[model samples]
Target: MTQQPHLFCFGLGYTALALARVLKQQGWRVTGTCRSTSNTEEARALGLEIVIFDPDHPVEGLAQRLAGVTHLLSSVPPGAAGDPVLQAHGATLAEAAPRLKWIGYLSTTGVYGDRQGGWVDEQSPLTPSGERGQRRLDAETAWLALPQPAHLFRLAGIYGPGRSVLDTIRAGKARRVLKPGQVFSRIHRDDIVQILLASFAHPNPGAAYNACDDDAADPAEVTAYACKLLNVAPPPEVPFAEAALSPMARSFYDDNKRVRNDRIKRELGVTLKYPDYRAGLTALLATESATSSSTTA
Candidate 1:
């Protein structure tokens, strides 16, 4: 029998859960942290060793629990109150660096602000336009500066399973909002997991990778495509300037950059499970429709 590495994950969110699932299947002893009691129970139910760690209510023995961990993965968002793992446990992790083989930090491609529909790669400069993007950029720097082999994964918009363009359309949010020549990159959650696993298999210290698909489609085209897939009329078109937007929504429009995933392919030797949104959304819709039909039958 092969000896699996012990994996410790911080911020067990959607993407983190996907990674955990894959790691567990590969025979790793997967453990994760949760801020709330309910989340702790949920993690336990998924066969993960759960630890409660909230900056607000600091728990004892956190360092001890993390002592023997070999691989560490963090999906915590970056902000004043967001990244508790980095703010509170950076030193603990640094101290345990000898045993730690690989550290993965989930970041956003937003770090490369609007390239005016141009392409950006891992070599691109970090110039985030929005506050959230800036925060992510800062966190990436903090993690890399630590005394460990850190791998930064700048993820594009993530969608999979319960989350996809078709889901948004079914939920009455398939609006065709155009920002002139605006384009955005995306990746399926499954593909993100595959890339992360590949990176783990071939560890690269201080390496940065963009986790996006091959296509950088226009946002309007994606929404319209989802409507067509669902056999529903596409939502009326709304120009960017004419649309009423929240601060967060408007910030998304600020970065029309296309992220390149060639580094992950070349370095990690990863082939994307869903190279484009078309295949991803179609698979998700088929599963959803099948589930609905079974429920009614």
Candidate 2:
């Protein structure tokens, strides 16, 4: 029998958990890092060798834990302006490159900035508008410059089982915010895992891929669709100027670019399981409804 490659994920967030679970099922000896002891135990119970590491405190056993790890994936978001991982662990990764076969860094498509509702592909120039977006772009550059084979995956807004438009509607927080021609792209957690697995199987070094769905729908349309599905009234439409926005939400609204996913499909030979939000949100709502019914029955 063929042996599966050993894998280590630096952050076991929502999307990372899906990727780790899929790899574990494929016979890979998967290990991951978390911030707390509870998360470490939870990850171990799910069959991942867990390591507790917080870049803020800088643990001592990182190098030892990563020993003999063939594949390494990082989903850690960038810190304030100067990220410690890039300043400190950047050299550490370079030193471990000879033994590490593949590395992946999760980034955000916000790096492209607002395209005025225009389309952007892999070849488009990156001009991040916000501080967070700029930091992520910088981190991507740092990872790509490493001596080892590294790939950057710029992900769109991610939604999954417990996180979707239906949940927002049920929580009475779904809003139809109209930003003129503003449209946003998103990818499901399952599809993110699929793309990552495909990249691992094929092993492309020093490459960048956009992980997004096929559809780029307006935010208003998405909320309306969710309300229709749930047989509820959609929230009142709010004008972009009058909408109450948090710092993060305002920053997100700054970029209205539609990211293209052709490179991941053509190069990675990947097919998205939830190609669009409609299919993804529909399935999530169905599952939620079933669970609700079962609990009440």
Candidate 3:
């Protein structure tokens, strides 16, 4: 008898929930771990069986949970203690890994560090400017060293649905920050799922891929475009030097690089649903319109 597809996500964040939704529709069994009981409630609303799992504080029954898991994906970020998933439950996963088809670790393009606004592929050097990026690099290494097939998806700025510049604009927090020659790569959340789904069909273990849209664009342009979509005037551009951002926020601007998504295309054959910010924002605005009308009606 052929085994059924089962996905066990370590952290059921926004992205994981989206993937679970599609997999459930495709007749796959899905289960996941969330940080808190409150998030577990939200996961249940998505029709997923979720357990309270805070890797920082250890939990039991992880071994039992791994029993029937055929595939695994971890979206959990690393911390000072390193990867919470590996530190807490690496042994159980290693035991279950041989039979598993694929394991994907959602890493950050920050792992590539500051590339002087240049371009980086999957094989770029891992020299992160901050401790957070270093931790992710460590986590990626640990996951890949596992005896199972593991794929690393180094993702750029992720935006979609309620988390895009559109939301920021509507919430009265939008800023047109201008730093000349500073371009950042962003990927739509839906496109991220599609890339993963495509990889699932191909199943290349020990492979690393960069996940980002074709357009590596200026933030000011994105801000102006969002305002255009909403029929609002764009905010005045604030030069990056005068923005007075927090250290964490400033750290983001330290790294500048355009990511190449050719591997996902050449290897997994993915054609991004939103190839650029313009396409993504237009589609999201349309969805917002339809959803608002339906809810009001």
Candidate 4:
């Protein structure tokens, strides 16, 4: 009998869960860690095993459960003390994960930081302009240093169902905060999931790929497009200085760089379902409408 693939995710959040759904269709056994089991009823219904996990609070006997794992992926961000998974179990995974073939660390494009709205590829300099970017860069380095074929995916802004500009506009909170020459790159959630699966199909140890769409567009442009689709007026433009945004939200505008995703296409031989926000938003709207219709019926 042929052994089936088993994937263990360190943080089963949006991106990881999306990948898990795809892998499940291929007869893969999926298990992951989350902050709480209480919120995992939906995940459990999908045949996933979710364990309560927090960096500050380690789960006992997790090491014993990692046998026969064929792949590992982490969507957990690094905290003040560094990446929670690597810091806690890097050594053990390296030594004991006998079946492990590929390991992936989900990183951010912020590590290339504030390129004056210029373009950045995988070979771009690691000059992060913010703490979040810097921490991700450090985490990328540490994960690569492990005794394994650890790959890094530096992702752009992630947006998808229940989390896109559509949701913001529906809640009447969509604002086109103006920051001149500030362009941002983004990836749909499903695209990120596809990239994860593609990497598994073609493993290149110590490789770094920028995961984003074909276009690096302006925030206002995307909002206007979403509003157009919904037949609602786009929120009036607000200057960045005048906009009432939290520190963290404001910090997003701090970095301005267009990420290039040539590597994923070149190496992984993958094509993106949503090449830009226009395609992604249209699909999300359709998906929402379908779900709404099903629920009402």
Per-residue error (Å), model 1, residue 68? 2.2
In the range 181-269, model 2's lDDT, one tens digit per residue, is: 89999999989998988888788888889999999999899888889898899899999898898877877788888889999899899
Q: Over the stretch 142-228, how does candidate 4's per-residue lDDT look in tens digits?
A: 888877758999999899988999999999889999988989999999999889889999998899999999999999989999999
Candidate 3's error at 147, in angstroms? 0.5
TM-score of 4: 0.96
Query: Which is the better candidate, 1 or 4, if ranked by TM-score?
Result: 4
For candidate 3, the TM-score is 0.97
Q: Which model scores highest in lDDT?
A: 3
Q: Candidate 1 or 2, higher TM-score? A: 1
Give the winner by TM-score: 3 or 4: 3
The lowest-lDDT stretch of 10 consecutive residues in candidate 1 is: 53-62
TM-score against native, each model: 0.94, 0.94, 0.97, 0.96
Q: After superposition, how far is residue 223 of candidate 3 from its true place, in Å?
A: 0.4
lDDT per residue as tens, model 3, 1-297: 877788999899988888999999998999988888866776787788887777656657877877788889999999899999889888888888888888999999999999888999998788998899999999999999889858999999999989999999999999988889999999999999999999889888889999999999999999999999999999888999999788988888999998999999999999999999999999999999999999999
Model 3 spans > 4 angstroms off = none
Those runs of model 1 whose alpha carbons end farther than 4 Å from true positions after fitting are: 1-3, 292-297
